[model samples]
Target: MKKFIYFIFGGVTFILGTIGIFLPILPTVPFYLASGFFWVRSSDQAYQFLLSNKWYQQYVTEWLVKRKMTVRQRIQILLILFVLLAIPFIAVPNTWMRLVLGCVFIGHCIFFIFFFDKKRTRQKISSENKIFFR
Candidate 1:
C-alpha cells in the first residue's frame, strides 16, 4: 500500500514536471527531483527511466551528482527565471507582491551565481551515455 501510494505520487509529479517543461510558471526541476525521489522509493524501473532520460541527463543529472552547472546552463536558467518572474513582477498590481517576487528573484540569482560550482572542461559528458566524470 505504501509503495502504491509512492508510485501514484511519483507518476503525478513526473507528469507535472513534464508539463512544466513547456510552462514557465511551473518549475520543472523540483518536480522532476521529487518524482525521482519517490520513484526510487517505490519503483526502481521508474527511477531508472528518469535517470536515463536524455533531457534529465542533459539539464539536471550533472547538478544532482556534483552540484555543478556549466556556464551556459547557469546563464540559460537565469534568463528563463528572469522571463518567467517578469510576469508577476510586472503584471501583478499589488506593490507588496511585486516586491516579494523581486526579492525571490534576487535571492535565486544570488544563490545560483554564488553557490553552484562552475563546470570544468574535464567534466566532459559522453554523448551516448551522458556520463560525466573528472
Candidate 2:
C-alpha cells in the first residue's frame, strides 16, 4: 500500500516535471520533488535514476540535500508565476471579483517572491526517511 502511493507520486511528478521542461508555466522542481519523495520510498533504482537524470536532479536534489536554490532558479520561478498570475486577470469576464482576485494574486505573488527562498524556505521540510534511508 505504501509502495503504491510512492509509485503514484513518482509517476505524477515525472510526468508533470517532463511537461514543465517544455512549458514554462509549469514548475519543474515541485513535480521532481514529488517524484523524488515517492521514488525514495518505493525503489532505490528509481530514486537513483531520478537523482542522476539529465535535468531533474539539478534543482530538485539541491533542495533535497542542501535545501538551497540557485539564484537563477528563483528568478525563473518568480518570472513564471508573475506571468501566470496575469493570465486569469486577462481572461476572466467578471469585473469586481476579478479585480479582487487580481489584487490578491498581485499581493500574493509579491509576498511570495519577496519572502520565499527558492533554495531553503520555498521547499517543503525534508523527510527523515529520505535522509536516513535514501
Candidate 3:
C-alpha cells in the first residue's frame, strides 16, 4: 500500500514535470526531483527509467552531481523566468511590488551567473578525456 501510493505520486509528478518542459511558468526541476524521490521509493524500474531519461540527465542529475549548468541551459532558464516575471512586473501598480519583482529578477540573474559555476572541474575533464581517447 505504501509503495502503491508512492508509485501514484511518482507518476503524477512525472507527468507534471513533462508538461512543465513546454510551459515556461511551470518549474520542471522540482517536479522531476519529486517524481524521482517517489519513484525511487516505490519501484526500481520506475527509478531506473527516470535515471535514464534525457530530461532527468540534463536538468536534475547534472545539477545534483556537478552543481553546474551549461551556459545554454542557464540562458534558456533565465529567458523563461524573465518572460514569466515580466508580465507581473509590468502590470502591478504598487511601487513596492514592482520593486520586489525587480529584486527577484536581479536575484535570479545573479544566482544563475555567480552561484551556478560554469567551469568544468578537473575530474570531469579527465573523465571526458578518457571517454574520448577510448
lDDT of each: 0.79, 0.74, 0.85
- Model 3, 12-110: lDDT tens per residue? 999999898888767789999999999999999999999899998877878756676778878887888888778888888788888888899899998
| Residue 67 error, candidate 3, Å | 3.5
Q: C-alpha displacement of 106 in model 3, angstroms?
A: 1.2
Global lDDT for candidate 2?
0.74
lDDT per residue (tens digit) for residues 1-134 in model 2: 98888887898889999898889877787888889889999989888989789787565655545555556766666667767766776787779867786787678667655455554453344555467677
lDDT score, candidate 2, position 118:
55
Model 2: residues >4 Å from true position, as ranges? Answer: 1-9, 63-67, 70-72, 95-134
lDDT score at residue 125, model 1, on the 0-100 scale: 39
Instruction: Identify the candidate with maximal lDDT.
Output: 3
RMSD of each: 6.3, 6.9, 4.9
Ranking by lDDT: 3, 1, 2
| TM-score rank order | 3, 1, 2
Candidate 1 yields a Cα-based lDDT of 0.79
Cα lDDT tens digits for candidate 1, 9-63: 9999888888887886777788988898899999899899999987677557767
Stretches off by above 4 angstroms in model 1 are: 119-134
